[model samples]
Target: MTETFITIFLVFMILAAVVALEARELLSTVIAVGAVGFMLSVIFLFLRAPDIAIVQIVVEILTLVILVRATISRDTHFFEDEREFFPFAINIVMIMVFLIFAFWAVKTLPRFGLNFSKVAPYYLTKGLAQTGAANIVTSVILDYRAYDTLGEATVLFTAVLGAVALLRRKAKAAENKNG
Candidate 1:
């Protein structure tokens, strides 16, 4: 079931990316890119990573807003050039290589419920005692993987800061216009 959902999301993301690439309008391309990001967030949820999903969605929304605003404010035009035969052939070969690499990586993924990490057994056994957390998940996330959690928090903070800065700049511009 999880695999099915992931596959579906991946397909949608790919379609969105292709749409973005082919789009003639700047807004259309931005919208298509936003779709890909939102779909990726959904896939993260299906993978049981709610924290990652939350961050992904927040960043995606902020990015879309900024991109759309820029598209509207500036005189942006997407001019598609005639594709040369050599460049088109190179792109096709690169895509094929990417597909082959993706297939190989998927095949190498560990089976669900199987832990490939050497630290997993230790964490499962000692996480509770070491962290004194009742929930194993909480203990592992807060105690064992504190650094990783901190990194994620930093990323979220940076995204919020960027959004605040953008908003503040817009407000100042409005105030200057009024003054």
Candidate 2:
């Protein structure tokens, strides 16, 4: 069952990525990215990592909201210049790089459930005793990995602030011109 779920979700993720790349409208691209993020969260959940899944969902929501708001006052459609060779070449190179990585991963990743690392069990057993937190998730994030969590929060806050500033500046510029 897990294998089937992983296989199906892998296909979904790949398709979402392709759609996001090909989407001609910025809004559609954003939606495609959200779809990819949702699929990733589901995959993480299926792998029994609720903490990662929750983080993915929350980050995805923030990213989508910020992207939509920042883009709201501007044209939403993507304009592709047919004469642009550099971008096309870059895209081709990226696809080649992705294909190479996929090939390498297929040959290298351990079989599912085979390498059951001792890390998870250790965390689950000693998390409460070490951190004095009853909730394993809370202890894992806010105590054991507090610095990483703080860094991620700081980055996310900075991104949201930047997006808000851009939109506010654009609005002010328009208002000044009109007034």
Candidate 3:
């Protein structure tokens, strides 16, 4: 039963990802991406990773809203004839190669039960005591590897600033032309 559930989840996730890639309409593609994230979150919850599931759900919701808003505010049409069958074929081949490599990597990964049994339990028991964080996810992310989180935030801020700068430049050029 569990295996069947997993298989179905995987199918949904893959189908959503593929549809997102192939969708010509920006809104449809964004919806498909959201579906992929939702399915992955379900899978994570099923695998007993509630923290990851919550994060995935939140990020998916936030990104989908942002993308939808951006799409609605833009003048660009989503579908372009420039994206042809050749690119689709190439994408399919690339996806297949990635899937193959991913499966290979997963098969070679260390068995969590055998290798990290003590680590997980110990953390679960002593994590709050050590970090004073109620949420294990927060404790792990903010306390254990804070530098990585800081770097990720920095990168996100940089991307946002770059996007804002580009948009402002475009707006200024449009204003100058109209004036």
Candidate 4:
């Protein structure tokens, strides 16, 4: 049941991404992107990563708010898309290849509700002993997988920086125009 939901949501996210890519209106593209992120957060929840899911949803909401605000404030909402046949054909082919690979990857996924990782057992058994943390999840996340946690934090930080930079640049441009 969970697997089916996750699969459906994944497909929806992919479709949303394509919609975002093809959308001519900036607001429409932002909404499609938000849909994709919302779906991703739900998928993370389905995978039992509630912490990650919360973070994902929070970030997604912030991004959507910022982008929607920016889009609405802009004078020109629609952009003309250049329809080059050769590039469009290449993109279509690439999307087809990606879908094929995604299907193959999904087929290879282990069944839900099963402990499939060899390292999980070790973590479960020795997590507390090694990390001196009472909670196994805490021990695993903070001690055993510290590097992975750091990498995730780095990615989130980078995204925030990029968003901030974009907004700042736009503000500077507006100031210059006004001056």
Best-performing candidate as measured by lDDT: 1
- After superposition, the stretches of candidate 2 with alpha carbons farther than 4 Å from their true spots are 83-106, 153-179
Off by over 4 Å in 1: 98-106, 132-179
> For model 4, what is the C-alpha lDDT against the true structure?
0.89
Full-model lDDT for every candidate = 0.89, 0.88, 0.86, 0.89
Flag clash pairs in model 1: none
lDDT of 1: 0.89
Alpha-carbon error at 169 in model 3, in Å?
Answer: 6.0
The residue ranges of model 3 lying beyond 4 angstroms of the native Cα positions read 1-3, 73-104, 111-122, 169-179
Q: Could you tell me the TM-score of candidate 2?
A: 0.69
**Model 4 agreement with the true structure over 101-130: per-residue lDDT tens digits:** 999898888866777889999988888788
lDDT of 3 by residue, 1-179 (tens): 65678789999889989899788888888889989989989988887789889899999999999998998788645676676798879988998999999998999877643554567777788999999999887887898878899999999999999899887757887888999
lDDT of 3: 0.86
lDDT of 2 by residue, 26-116 (tens): 8888889999999999999999888889989999999999988877768676758564799889989999999999998888877778857
- The residue pairs in collision within model 4 are none
Q: Which ten residues in a row have the lowest lDDT in candidate 2?
A: 75-84
